[model samples]
Target: MSATRVQVVPNGPVLVSGPVRIEMPDGDVVESDRFMVAICTCRRSDDYPLCDTSHRRCRNVSAAPERLGDRIEREAR
Candidate 1:
Protein backbone atom coordinates (compact mmCIF):
# COMPACT_ATOMS: atom_id res chain seq x y z
CA MET A 1 0.00 0.00 0.00
CA SER A 2 1.20 3.48 -0.82
CA ALA A 3 0.26 6.95 0.33
CA THR A 4 -2.87 8.25 -1.32
CA ARG A 5 -2.59 11.59 -3.09
CA VAL A 6 -5.58 13.95 -3.31
CA GLN A 7 -5.79 16.78 -5.81
CA VAL A 8 -8.33 19.58 -5.75
CA VAL A 9 -9.61 20.71 -9.10
CA PRO A 10 -10.92 24.20 -9.74
CA ASN A 11 -14.76 23.98 -9.78
CA GLY A 12 -14.55 20.22 -10.06
CA PRO A 13 -14.18 16.93 -8.21
CA VAL A 14 -11.47 15.90 -5.80
CA LEU A 15 -9.10 13.54 -7.56
CA VAL A 16 -7.88 10.72 -5.34
CA SER A 17 -5.48 7.83 -5.79
CA GLY A 18 -7.30 4.78 -4.66
CA PRO A 19 -8.02 1.35 -3.32
CA VAL A 20 -10.19 3.57 -1.18
CA ARG A 21 -13.25 2.76 0.88
CA ILE A 22 -15.74 5.57 1.44
CA GLU A 23 -18.18 5.27 4.34
CA MET A 24 -21.51 6.92 3.67
CA PRO A 25 -23.72 8.68 6.18
CA ASP A 26 -26.29 5.90 5.87
CA GLY A 27 -23.72 3.31 7.01
CA ASP A 28 -23.00 2.05 3.53
CA VAL A 29 -19.46 1.59 2.29
CA VAL A 30 -18.23 2.15 -1.26
CA GLU A 31 -14.97 0.53 -2.28
CA SER A 32 -13.01 1.36 -5.37
CA ASP A 33 -10.54 -1.01 -6.99
CA ARG A 34 -9.30 1.52 -9.56
CA PHE A 35 -5.99 3.36 -9.29
CA MET A 36 -7.83 6.66 -9.19
CA VAL A 37 -11.28 8.02 -8.33
CA ALA A 38 -13.09 11.34 -8.44
CA ILE A 39 -15.06 12.45 -5.42
CA CYS A 40 -17.92 14.83 -6.10
CA THR A 41 -18.09 18.04 -4.05
CA CYS A 42 -21.02 19.68 -5.88
CA ARG A 43 -23.51 17.04 -4.62
CA ARG A 44 -25.06 16.92 -8.11
CA SER A 45 -23.83 13.52 -9.12
CA ASP A 46 -26.34 10.74 -9.63
CA ASP A 47 -23.49 8.54 -8.44
CA TYR A 48 -23.02 9.79 -4.92
CA PRO A 49 -19.46 10.21 -3.63
CA LEU A 50 -18.24 9.82 -7.18
CA CYS A 51 -17.81 12.22 -10.09
CA ASP A 52 -19.95 11.43 -13.13
CA THR A 53 -19.09 14.80 -14.73
CA SER A 54 -22.44 16.23 -13.67
CA HIS A 55 -20.83 19.26 -12.06
CA ARG A 56 -20.38 20.98 -15.40
CA ARG A 57 -22.84 23.76 -16.09
CA CYS A 58 -25.00 23.53 -19.21
CA ARG A 59 -27.01 26.39 -20.68
CA ASN A 60 -30.02 26.04 -22.94
CA VAL A 61 -29.77 28.85 -25.49
CA SER A 62 -33.15 28.02 -27.02
CA ALA A 63 -34.88 28.51 -23.70
CA ALA A 64 -33.20 31.88 -23.23
CA PRO A 65 -34.83 33.26 -26.40
CA GLU A 66 -38.23 32.08 -25.24
CA ARG A 67 -37.73 33.63 -21.82
CA LEU A 68 -36.72 36.94 -23.39
CA GLY A 69 -39.86 36.94 -25.53
CA ASP A 70 -42.02 36.28 -22.49
CA ARG A 71 -40.41 39.17 -20.60
CA ILE A 72 -40.99 41.57 -23.50
CA GLU A 73 -44.65 40.52 -23.81
CA ARG A 74 -45.19 41.03 -20.06
CA GLU A 75 -43.68 44.53 -20.14
CA ALA A 76 -45.87 45.54 -23.10
CA ARG A 77 -49.10 44.68 -21.18
Candidate 2:
Protein backbone atom coordinates (compact mmCIF):
# COMPACT_ATOMS: atom_id res chain seq x y z
CA MET A 1 0.00 0.00 0.00
CA SER A 2 1.14 3.54 -0.69
CA ALA A 3 1.27 6.36 1.80
CA THR A 4 -1.53 8.94 1.63
CA ARG A 5 -0.67 12.53 0.81
CA VAL A 6 -1.94 15.36 2.99
CA GLN A 7 -1.60 19.02 2.13
CA VAL A 8 -2.34 21.76 4.61
CA VAL A 9 -4.08 24.87 3.36
CA PRO A 10 -3.58 28.06 5.30
CA ASN A 11 -6.74 28.87 7.28
CA GLY A 12 -8.57 26.15 5.35
CA PRO A 13 -9.10 22.44 4.99
CA VAL A 14 -6.44 19.78 4.52
CA LEU A 15 -6.35 18.08 1.15
CA VAL A 16 -5.92 14.34 1.38
CA SER A 17 -5.64 11.46 -1.04
CA GLY A 18 -8.82 9.50 -0.86
CA PRO A 19 -10.71 6.17 -0.93
CA VAL A 20 -10.49 6.72 2.80
CA ARG A 21 -12.40 5.68 5.86
CA ILE A 22 -12.79 7.84 8.93
CA GLU A 23 -13.79 6.69 12.37
CA MET A 24 -15.48 9.38 14.37
CA PRO A 25 -15.17 10.01 18.11
CA ASP A 26 -18.74 8.77 18.57
CA GLY A 27 -17.84 5.51 16.77
CA ASP A 28 -19.65 6.44 13.59
CA VAL A 29 -17.69 5.72 10.45
CA VAL A 30 -17.51 7.75 7.26
CA GLU A 31 -16.03 6.59 4.01
CA SER A 32 -15.11 8.29 0.76
CA ASP A 33 -13.95 6.80 -2.50
CA ARG A 34 -13.20 10.05 -4.27
CA PHE A 35 -9.75 10.58 -5.75
CA MET A 36 -9.14 13.38 -3.27
CA VAL A 37 -10.87 14.71 -0.20
CA ALA A 38 -10.89 17.97 1.66
CA ILE A 39 -10.78 17.37 5.37
CA CYS A 40 -11.95 20.18 7.59
CA THR A 41 -9.43 21.80 9.90
CA CYS A 42 -11.28 24.96 10.94
CA ARG A 43 -14.12 23.07 12.67
CA ARG A 44 -16.61 25.31 10.87
CA SER A 45 -18.04 22.60 8.64
CA ASP A 46 -21.53 21.31 9.30
CA ASP A 47 -20.17 18.05 7.89
CA TYR A 48 -17.65 17.98 10.77
CA PRO A 49 -14.62 16.15 9.38
CA LEU A 50 -15.26 17.07 5.78
CA CYS A 51 -14.67 20.48 4.28
CA ASP A 52 -17.68 22.43 3.07
CA THR A 53 -15.73 25.62 2.27
CA SER A 54 -17.06 27.23 5.42
CA HIS A 55 -13.69 28.79 6.24
CA ARG A 56 -14.28 31.25 3.43
CA ARG A 57 -16.87 32.93 5.64
CA CYS A 58 -14.29 33.91 8.24
CA ARG A 59 -14.82 37.54 9.28
CA ASN A 60 -11.28 38.00 10.54
CA VAL A 61 -8.82 38.29 7.72
CA SER A 62 -5.19 39.01 8.49
CA ALA A 63 -2.61 40.26 6.03
CA ALA A 64 0.16 38.56 7.99
CA PRO A 65 0.66 34.86 8.02
CA GLU A 66 0.15 33.32 11.45
CA ARG A 67 3.12 31.65 13.07
CA LEU A 68 2.82 27.99 14.08
CA GLY A 69 3.78 28.69 17.68
CA ASP A 70 1.18 31.42 18.05
CA ARG A 71 -1.51 29.21 16.57
CA ILE A 72 -0.61 26.38 18.95
CA GLU A 73 -0.71 28.71 21.94
CA ARG A 74 -4.06 30.16 20.96
CA GLU A 75 -5.62 26.78 20.30
CA ALA A 76 -4.29 25.41 23.58
CA ARG A 77 -6.70 27.69 25.39
Candidate 3:
Protein backbone atom coordinates (compact mmCIF):
# COMPACT_ATOMS: atom_id res chain seq x y z
CA MET A 1 0.00 0.00 0.00
CA SER A 2 1.26 3.46 -0.82
CA ALA A 3 1.51 5.98 1.99
CA THR A 4 -0.46 9.19 1.70
CA ARG A 5 0.69 12.73 2.36
CA VAL A 6 -1.12 16.04 2.72
CA GLN A 7 0.66 19.34 3.27
CA VAL A 8 -0.41 22.93 3.83
CA VAL A 9 1.71 25.42 1.95
CA PRO A 10 2.64 28.81 3.36
CA ASN A 11 0.48 30.52 0.75
CA GLY A 12 -0.76 27.80 -1.49
CA PRO A 13 -3.40 25.10 -1.78
CA VAL A 14 -3.22 21.87 0.10
CA LEU A 15 -0.43 19.92 -1.60
CA VAL A 16 -1.82 16.42 -1.53
CA SER A 17 -0.27 13.59 -3.48
CA GLY A 18 0.57 9.93 -3.34
CA PRO A 19 -1.89 7.09 -2.97
CA VAL A 20 -4.62 8.59 -0.89
CA ARG A 21 -8.36 8.97 -0.87
CA ILE A 22 -10.07 12.34 -0.44
CA GLU A 23 -13.18 12.07 1.63
CA MET A 24 -15.71 14.85 1.88
CA PRO A 25 -17.46 15.77 5.11
CA ASP A 26 -20.61 14.16 3.80
CA GLY A 27 -18.98 10.77 3.88
CA ASP A 28 -18.04 10.93 0.26
CA VAL A 29 -14.59 9.70 -0.66
CA VAL A 30 -13.05 10.18 -4.07
CA GLU A 31 -9.78 9.71 -5.90
CA SER A 32 -7.69 12.33 -7.65
CA ASP A 33 -7.12 12.30 -11.37
CA ARG A 34 -3.37 12.49 -10.91
CA PHE A 35 -1.03 11.64 -8.13
CA MET A 36 -0.90 15.29 -7.21
CA VAL A 37 -3.71 17.82 -7.09
CA ALA A 38 -3.35 21.54 -6.39
CA ILE A 39 -6.56 22.82 -4.91
CA CYS A 40 -7.38 26.49 -5.29
CA THR A 41 -5.88 28.59 -2.55
CA CYS A 42 -7.55 31.67 -3.85
CA ARG A 43 -11.33 31.64 -3.65
CA ARG A 44 -11.69 33.77 -6.77
CA SER A 45 -11.66 30.79 -9.05
CA ASP A 46 -14.11 30.16 -11.85
CA ASP A 47 -13.41 26.46 -12.28
CA TYR A 48 -13.66 24.93 -8.91
CA PRO A 49 -13.27 21.15 -8.35
CA LEU A 50 -10.05 22.01 -10.14
CA CYS A 51 -7.54 24.81 -10.03
CA ASP A 52 -8.08 27.58 -12.58
CA THR A 53 -4.88 29.47 -11.85
CA SER A 54 -6.80 31.95 -9.74
CA HIS A 55 -4.10 31.95 -7.14
CA ARG A 56 -2.30 34.53 -9.23
CA ARG A 57 -4.95 37.07 -8.32
CA CYS A 58 -4.40 36.54 -4.62
CA ARG A 59 -0.69 36.04 -5.27
CA ASN A 60 -0.89 32.79 -3.38
CA VAL A 61 -0.39 29.17 -4.22
CA SER A 62 -3.96 27.91 -3.96
CA ALA A 63 -7.17 28.14 -2.01
CA ALA A 64 -7.72 26.92 1.49
CA PRO A 65 -9.74 23.93 2.57
CA GLU A 66 -13.24 24.02 4.05
CA ARG A 67 -13.91 26.29 6.99
CA LEU A 68 -14.56 23.34 9.27
CA GLY A 69 -14.67 20.29 7.13
CA ASP A 70 -11.83 18.17 5.80
CA ARG A 71 -8.60 18.56 7.74
CA ILE A 72 -5.01 17.77 6.60
CA GLU A 73 -2.27 16.68 8.94
CA ARG A 74 0.95 14.68 8.74
CA GLU A 75 1.11 11.21 10.10
CA ALA A 76 3.95 10.33 12.46
CA ARG A 77 6.17 7.48 11.41
Model 2 TM-score is 0.70
TM-score of each: 0.68, 0.70, 0.52
Ranking of all predicted structures according to TM-score, beginning with the best and ending with the worst? 2, 1, 3
| Candidate 1 weakest lDDT stretch, 10 residues | 58-67
lDDT tens digits by residue: candidate 1, 10-70: 5677788977799999999988989999987667789979888777763321243345445
**Superior by lDDT: candidate 1 or candidate 2:** 2
**Can you write out model 3's per-residue Cα lDDT over 1-77, one digit (the tens) per residue?**
66666665655455667644566568877566688876655656575444566766666433345431234332332
Off by over 4 Å in 1: 58-77
Question: lDDT of candidate 1 vs native?
Answer: 0.74
lDDT of each: 0.74, 0.74, 0.56
- Candidate numbers, best lDDT first, in rank order: 2, 1, 3
Say which candidate scores most in TM-score: 2
Evaluate residue 33 in candidate 2 and report its C-alpha lDDT on the 0 to 100 scale: 91
